[model samples]
Target: MSGADIANVCNEAALTAARHNEEYVKLHDFEQAIERVIAGLEKKTKLLSPDEKKVVAYHEAGHAICGWYLEYADPLLKVSIVPRGQGALGYAQYLPADIFLYTTQKLLDRMTMTLGGRVSEELHFNSVTSGASDDFEKVTGLAQRMVLQCGMSPKIGTISYTIDRGQDMTKPYSERTAKTIDSEIRRIVDECHERCKNLLIEKADQVELVAQELLTKEVITREDMIRLLGKRPFANRNDAFDKYLASKDEKGDD
Candidate 1:
């Protein structure tokens, strides 16, 4: 975020503290402020039916569970079923590491994490919903970049294609190559979706636990995740992210 964004967040956080009649701004106030800045204000007045709420809870839980298990996926910070922004019915936030480069496995893991919500809906409800439109968009973009720009696809040799988004001109490749690119993108996304579906199936019990908790509380923190799913398996995870959470926990104890 830019300096202006930071200033806005701090200002909003102070306003949140004032609204709560607190003598000082707290870490949670800043957290809420950041959420407001990123997700827009919470839509408490926007109501959902019982069935819709249940689907949302499970969908978010699927994301959290997938990120929790994936070795290269970002560490989950929070998950919530409470409606936010204009179109978001639920969301899963992750503490992404400060890394410059990404490996093929890492990218694939992230794609699987992105597909978790949709796969979860399919597994549990035996149906899919338009709620996954954003996920599909993100996954498709990443897969295209991986194949066309990054040359990560084995089928397509290492060749980077520059796409000028400003122009409606034809792609700088043969029609046959375009077909191959489309096929490669579909292959990558389908593989990630399968991986996500398998992971959710294996951890079905934990998904249920997290979903039930979300149904009751509407929000679940990192602490809640650890309690429900146990520690993440990866040993070399982000230390700074862990320390931030620890600091928040200590402040809550005070």
Candidate 2:
């Protein structure tokens, strides 16, 4: 039966019990049932293995640190090594904010964050693994967003180049323009990869520490991040490049 039908049944039962002077039958039964269901689901949350959890923590910590450090991205909220549904392994939560326009530097920094997790794995494990599958997906999506959605692409010009039905895909553009776009996409990916590599290299020690904390706590708070880093990266971030970072830091949520 529908939830409303069940509620109606409960209501009738409660009214009958009340007529017989039974106690505690006047409560909001539906709300109480929903709360119990929610609590049960919450208790069923899954977790990762020790090594995998550590990997997730450091991986996400890398992104959080890079975000706070860049001064152009969003401030780090909570960092979790906890495994979520769909084999997430771990996740880093950032404050959701709108992006109207992106500067070249901001776009670069975002790409760095998207790839930060995979780079962390390579740095820590002395070898790469499939744990970064998600990172690759995120990076690809970010690159496409930059080139196709955000117009940060230099070759495609300020206008977006999109596919429409009955349009030419084989002869999409001049051979020269097509080649230029390919070059631009590669440059964008290469530059972001380098940025992530450099950031991870510089924070090599902190990365280990953060990963260790994840192994211990399964989740790292913003305060945990600050304590591990000794200072916030947002403090000295570039204003023009990291304006959003500073703004999020100021608001101080998550």
Candidate 3:
């Protein structure tokens, strides 16, 4: 995925890097390029006020904390409260697994992490915000896919009612089946939301700590994360990245 993203950048990013006294684009340039492609260019001066900044800090801190505690979540890379893209007040970056493979547990954890922001808002402010619009869209899509496409829904059996691309004009399943699928998807997401919300509440102090620090620094790296929240859940995609880094160090004799 990242390789394809880099390809799409052509040499424009490399050229931009050269202007900074770099002879060639390094991996950091590509990393920044990818983040820009997804999250939009970082808006140096944000539109957020002091209170808004605090909310955003906690909102993003919640995401990082959930990812840290969840065994199946993608490993944390960084968390930031600086505004980026359209309305992204803040975001948590993760080192996702390379493979497309996903088990039910992993999917659930992903949904939980997505709900983290809303959960945090509700916990800290007794309200919610539009910050989680993208998260809910992602959660809904994953739940529906799990049921309708992946056939991971035991209640729905191993039946798939997937409509092919551009086939939305036709009904793939009956009205009753569609209703059932929608209900199931809602149930899955609602349950995960409550579970994640409770976890955030339980770890309220840690969440507050991370939020306070985020408001101070505006960005937190993996080492900063480890000091604040301890090590992530044991061995998964993050561990895989570690192995890759090790190999690179060996080859470069670093």
TM-score top scorer: 1
**Per-residue lDDT over 1-254 for candidate 2, one digit per residue giving the tens place of the 0 to 100 score:** 46886776576656555666867664544433333332221224564566666667777767776776775676665676655556566667665456687787876777788888878877777666686777677777677667765788756867665645375556446778767777777788888888888988997887778778877887776678778776554555433424766788889974
Residue range with the least summed lDDT across 10 consecutive positions in model 3: 232-241
Poorly placed runs, candidate 2 (over 4 Å): 1-47, 148-151, 165-171, 236-254
With a 3 Å backbone cut-off (N, CA, C), the pairs that clash in candidate 2 are: 71-242, 72-242, 77-254
With a 3 Å backbone cut-off (N, CA, C), the pairs that clash in candidate 1 are: none
lDDT of 3 by residue, 1-254 (tens): 47776676655477558768888778777766766766777897767899899889989988988988898888887788889988788888777877578999989998999899888998899667778888989999999899988988877889877767584678778889888888899899999999998899889999998999999999888889889877665754455567777899999995
What's the TM-score of every candidate structure? Answer: 0.93, 0.69, 0.87
lDDT (0 to 1) per candidate: 0.91, 0.68, 0.84
Models ranked on lDDT: 1, 3, 2
Candidate 3: C-alpha lDDT = 0.84
Could you give me the TM-score of model 2 versus the true structure?
0.69
Tell how far residue 47 is off in model 1, in angstroms.
0.9
Ranking by TM-score: 1, 3, 2
Residues 38-135, model 1: lDDT tens digits: 77889989999999999999999999999999999988888988899878899887878777999999999999999999999998996778999999
TM-score of 1: 0.93
